[model samples]
Target: MESNQEVQISTNAIISFTDSYTQNKQRKEKELLEFESKSARAIISFTDSYAQNKQRKQNEQQESESTLSLAQVTSRLESLSNQIQYNNGCKLVIQIPKLLQSLIALVTFRIGTHLKQEIDLQRIEVRRQSRWCLSSIQVYGDEQIQSELVRQGYGRVMSITLSKAGGIDEEQDEEIYNGLRSISRFLRGLHAGRNNDYQPSFQPLPLLARRSIEQLEEEGANEEIEAQMNNRYNGLIKVWANDAKDMILNCFIYRRRR
Candidate 1:
């Protein structure tokens, strides 16, 4: 009987030990799973943070570079402004020859490899820019500078540019009108209040004005194209005609004053 009781006790102890070992193994597995999940989460969070930081740094660097570029541009503009204000545009005076050459090329539209219409548009822009440049020179320059331009044959060159209409294609009607407008502006800039004797011996502004008006009248009366007739380019031509009239009157008044 004692042997049988000892056998039963050994079997119960073995079963309890096995149950306890199984519970411990399950708990260790749960802990290991939780640790692995936390590690994965930590890696994900670190990667996301690193990416955000890298992008932020790149954006900041770009912003900083943009700011530096803007600052440099501002500094240069301020320096140029100071130079222009203090020295009466001495720098501009020194660059007159180069400026004239560039303006001449632009006004003539002789340096492009674009479509015909696009080139014509560019020519219009360049002509307008040239007029503005000349106007600026007239406004900023004194009599001495004006005389220097005259001595440099600026008057002769401008007159010829106007007379030739900058070599614009005649088929480009709009460009023709624009050329006339710009030519009137060029003439005004060249000799608004200047002495007649000081002006280049080119065709007189009054005579040129008459010729331009007559040409416009002829075109309006004689053009057979339906598009040309409906365009009323002659009406628009009056804008340049009026400008020429003003130039003529100014020339007469200036001559009388002299």
Candidate 2:
């Protein structure tokens, strides 16, 4: 009777042990599945985020490329509009050496042809090249190039030369060229001002008549003319220089608002 009872108890213990082992195995399997599911979800989310970032970057790159293309287009248009084309097929497109050569040829031709003398092309070429080299060179390396040039009367000489090089409409070409020379001369003063009158302000060349200033000075220095010296050219020079076609623009932002 005791052996029978012992056997039954042993069976019950074995059954209980088997059931616990099975439950533990099932829990481990469920945990493994949960871990795999979480890993998969993480991978998918990362892929989506990476794809979105890549697309955003591509869009930005495209927009930047478009902006760059527009800038290039605008630059080309401005260059085309400003480029000067001579009847002799020489185009002035901001190239210093080529423009210098054209200027020399034109100047030499004008001088030689007008006097019915032969042109010294070699001499002209050499002088033009040497002048080109000298243009950027510093008398003492100060960026205020105007004082050095002005002291030497370089602006006056250049103005005279531009006036003499006659091919285009003389009045128009001379006006444009002279204005360019003046602006160039003024630019040299920008880095380190030499003319005490020219402060760091952005006021362009004052076009008040030289005679008007002299007269105003002589007549006990009129209060109005004294004030005019500060900003008078702002009102006058553009009207004197702009063409009739371009004059239409002055009706808006250009004309004094006051």
C-alpha RMSD of each candidate structure in angstroms: 35.1, 37.9
- The models' CA-based lDDT, in order, is 0.43, 0.33
**Per-residue alpha-carbon lDDT of model 2 for 116-219, expressed as tens digits?**
11223322332233233223322212323223333433433333333333332433343334333332333333322343432323322222122222322343
Instruction: Choose the strongest candidate by lDDT.
Output: 1
TM-score, cand. 2 vs. native? 0.25
Assess every candidate by TM-score.
Answer: 0.36, 0.25
Which lDDT value does model 2 have at 76?
Answer: 31
Candidate 1 C-alpha lDDT tens digits along 1-258: 443343234333323332343454465467557656765779857666556655664554345334324233223323333343444553353353344443333343332323366544544554444444444454455455454544444444444444444325553454445544554554464454344443323322343333433443343422222222244547665566566546534555543453
lDDT of 2: 0.33
Backbone atom clashes (below 3 Å) for every candidate:
0, 0
